[model samples]
Target: MNEEFVLETKGKNRLIISPNQYCFIKLPSSGIKIVQLRPDGVISLGKFGCFEVNSVLNHPYGETFEIIENKQARAIYTDAFEAGNDDEDLEEENISEAEISSKLLSTDKENKSRLDNRDVNDIGSGVQKLTSVEIELLKKDSELSNKGKGIIEKLIESHTNFNKKTVHSQEKYVKRKQQKFLKVFTIEYLSASNLLRFYTSKDFGKIHELSEESLGLMISLADVRPGGRYLVVDECLGLIVYTMMERMNLQGEIVLIHENEHANLISLKYSDYSEEEIKKFVKTINWLQFFEPDNEKIKFPIKSETEISLLTAQKRSNYYRHKRNAEITNSVIDNVKRGQFDGLIMASTLYLPKLLPKIVDKIGGSRAIVCYSNNKELLNETNHVLLNDVRVINSKILETRVRPYQSIPGKLHPLMTIRSGGGYLLWGLRVIPGDKIKATGRGNKKS
Candidate 1:
């Protein structure tokens, strides 16, 4: 009776954007917004304007649409952002090759004459007509009145030195302004990676500023496969688990150990996965249960015969329910204690030095152990500990960064700002040593 309809991307309508499922809309400003569209619903894009959900139903994602009069929308080519695009976009989303590279080389022409920025300081050296306080007021007014385009135009007109800037500089300034003022958006399919991007744009700290590369790398290092058991300790708001679920593809079992009484799976709350599938695919246990599964459960299970003889018919049925639950709980505890898990993948703030030893044995031999943290020192200490323990070999810390650049021919160069703080990972392999590792400290000392 409690069924949650998860939007499936596998059916004939996989390409079609349907109603009543969580969708991530990509604003022209590069901001992402999530919504569950209803049949006759109207969603507002704030200063970008509002439109009816049904107006864009059945359309494939990644196509840009302009909001016309009377809340209407039609196909439009967005050339404003064609100059600089990253390969990550081509890999993350499902955009065709021609679409992204259509006009990529248009900006490759020889350098143009530009203005000399003799005075571009923080203190208004006459670059801007509005003061800091005045600009704040202007923003508030524009946001409240839903008039961003006018405000942007007014600001550009107010700039005393706009004409003096170089052609390249002027284009950069306008592109930045249009990014904030343009009232346009593209509908994006909610893939796991896209969902991570949505949260990253909204708040980088929420997901530890996780990069697509790092997340994908962790899955690879762990070597996650169908039917393999995984032990996960995710403190990144269940993002790690959600991404893993996509890789598991509803085949393997993910035993999630939550730090709280209830699993902090807010990211998965809006997922299209059914409650039944989630229940079957993901098994949960508290830290106490995972660290110590034998105390209350190591003893004999609830005596069904004793409870049945003392209780009424209704009470006996209740007893059976309790008995079944007890059995399931013990089963999970037994499996974890038996060391059958395929891998140990963790992304928590807990001290790795003290935590690694406790959970390392859970993973099967010749398996992988991948630990992630935003701070490098955490992994540094983890790496040191893993190398000392002969069971874990090839321990090292690795960081991933996705750099973007201007793709025009002859002008290929790195962008001013690149992705920062995707996080560091401590990767190693688990081994079962047949003999204790011993070394002789000769006059040369141990190598």
Candidate 2:
């Protein structure tokens, strides 16, 4: 019923960038940078540029903007023409076949009256004539003006054989230059896929190299949805919890078990869900308390407000603290004892053989039990144990990967390099076993 909870429940609108929501800024050359949109703040894009948060406050996601500096205020270019009026305009209107052919020729041949037959070494940096110092000066000037078109044009003019490359090669060269000098960036909403991408670029180890596809599959195989109670053990810095929450849409409850005294849900802080919203859905308890909660040791009588007022301040504080802990411990123990969790999901480093037996019974009958590990060997070991257990059925080990391709027109091909692994999943269904059958001397019979 809270506004933050409702917003996440109903899904965010792509047309508006909300305050405190994580979003992606697609840099011209640096891929994407994920940033939270803080109100009335400045987002510095390093050497590219900086702009006020208000510039993109209510703009639609997926729209690109070019940052431009102003003495009085920061400005952005949203239209193509506003970006530049030099080579881009020329390329559109004044390109000729003869010029393209000439550009494709060698620099020495281009200097002649016509194309000449001569071998030319093209591997080195002999095409451009601008000195590093001069280029840096141009970059400084462009930064001051908050425009890169002029700098790119100047570089192209300085190229010794700008008119000697093929049309496609020329276009590629221009694009590369633009990437180097352009101050443009695109805004994207922070979905699961985007978040994974951001983290993968920053630090793959943090999320255990979990890809977007693998994550989606894990959630689907676990049957995570609204109104379901899930027992989760997340060791990927709360990535699994965030994904589950996205799928659940703030509708269900998550009983999270952690190895530490306090759960390390650091990743969730960057998520769009507020603290209140997350508290409503996620309940965390340490492994010790979850497995061996001493409810009686912490139990105490609930004191009335008037009665507590009579006690000293220090005593009252201690009493309330113990009461809170007791309530939390009791709640966790009661939920585990209920034995009605719809699913059991874990992505921890603990031995699955030892861990599963301790918590597998917490899941309800005909429910899912999914465990994810970056190493296949770990899942393989878990698979064998789950297959032998009578309480689990249809155990399987699965791996999901996403192959990337260079999508250039007329030159499409698989990328030469890509992230090698997307980790693996161990899946099974929890079931209730019936009475066991006993064998007689010559025939099978019930005991």
Candidate 3:
């Protein structure tokens, strides 16, 4: 009986159990698996249903979860992993509102008994019931896609304790972390500036640059305000998005123009808001994806008749109307020049000095925030380009590192391989808007 716990994997690529907490479970039988929760919950994949271990939580950590099928007609349970085959099915079928509502309700008494018998304390000592309204909200939000809805539906349908009240309460609890201005998506432990300051104030760690605190530092430095338009690029699992969502007013919008399929925007899984609330929150931001063509591409050469031409007939009497606007290739640079953005934030591993200028050109009168790796060549080249451009006001590089504290003196372990660049940041703003200083006729004017 060690403290270690077990998790099962399902057909999904990953089932987000907690902000940072995750475990991949391998099925002993079929390929179909389920991702088990550390404390209690278990999310099934594909056709398989899911339930919690609250009834079994009191059992020892190493205790195996048996999915024994009853001879009587009740429910079927199995351990198998489908290679995201369900995702393809999800894209094809559109789940009805009726089905969503029905799935949100709880399962039968037998399942309830099973849940009660499981380790309730392990499920979470603070777990509370969710209201019907909250469950409805979750149903709505969980409707991201067929697969997304199915996951939520299966969870509630199998677990008796999982009602609207519990779902809603859990959502509130999970989402509350966003309010505290901390990154929820990090796998590695990070020391943020605010947290570091707290540590120093409490005499925890030696005063040094806190690498883990970069997000807090960047947020503070950017000075993001209400109603400000920002051009941002971050692969840090939407930590920046969560921070912005918390800091920004209701009217604020964060346009995420990303290249990756599973960017920070898609990775946002909330436990606080119901599926509906999460969907509503997701709808607020504009996802200007470069790869996916969920919508027809906005054609180039803006013409008056182009809008009408863009409208295609879905059937004899129906038509598929699309918004025909400037393409990203043609209009992105121009959009930056029109002063549409209040600030610019770009964080990526790729070096885009040549293309970045185009991005900066569009940023008229806004601060340019760039994040780079420890590799000086890439950053140096970018720095040179920024200096050449008159719009760039000032530029500096900030470095951050995390040092473990209060550890046993002789404890030793192998070093871990972290993502390259070790969190290096490059920040700058527009050069213009300043009073001209009189020259003393000695040398060139200082910026």
For each candidate, the alpha-carbon lDDT, in order, equals: 0.71, 0.72, 0.40
Taking the tens digit of each residue's C-alpha lDDT, what string does model 3 give over 2-116? Answer: 0111111122212222322223233322222223345544444322223343433333222233332221111212111111111122322444332233223323222323323
TM-score winner between 1 and 3, please give it. Answer: 1
**After superposing candidate 1, which stretches have Cα over 4 Å from the reference?**
1-14, 83-162, 298-324, 407-411, 435-447
Better of 1 and 3 by lDDT: 1
Off by over 4 Å in 3: 1-211, 237-239, 249-251, 260-264, 269-318, 321-338, 364-368, 407-421, 433-447
lDDT of 3 at 204: 27
On lDDT, the leading prediction is 2
Supply the global lDDT for candidate 3: 0.40
Tens digits of per-residue lDDT for model 1 on 192-309? Answer: 7888888787777888877888999998999987566889988888888888776766666888888778778888876677776777777778888888787746443466576569
lDDT of 2 by residue, 168-206 (tens): 455556666667777777787776677778888988888
* TM-score of candidate 2 relative to the true fold: 0.82
Backbone Cα, N, C clashes tallied per candidate = 3, 5, 46
Model 2: ten consecutive residues of lowest lDDT: 438-447
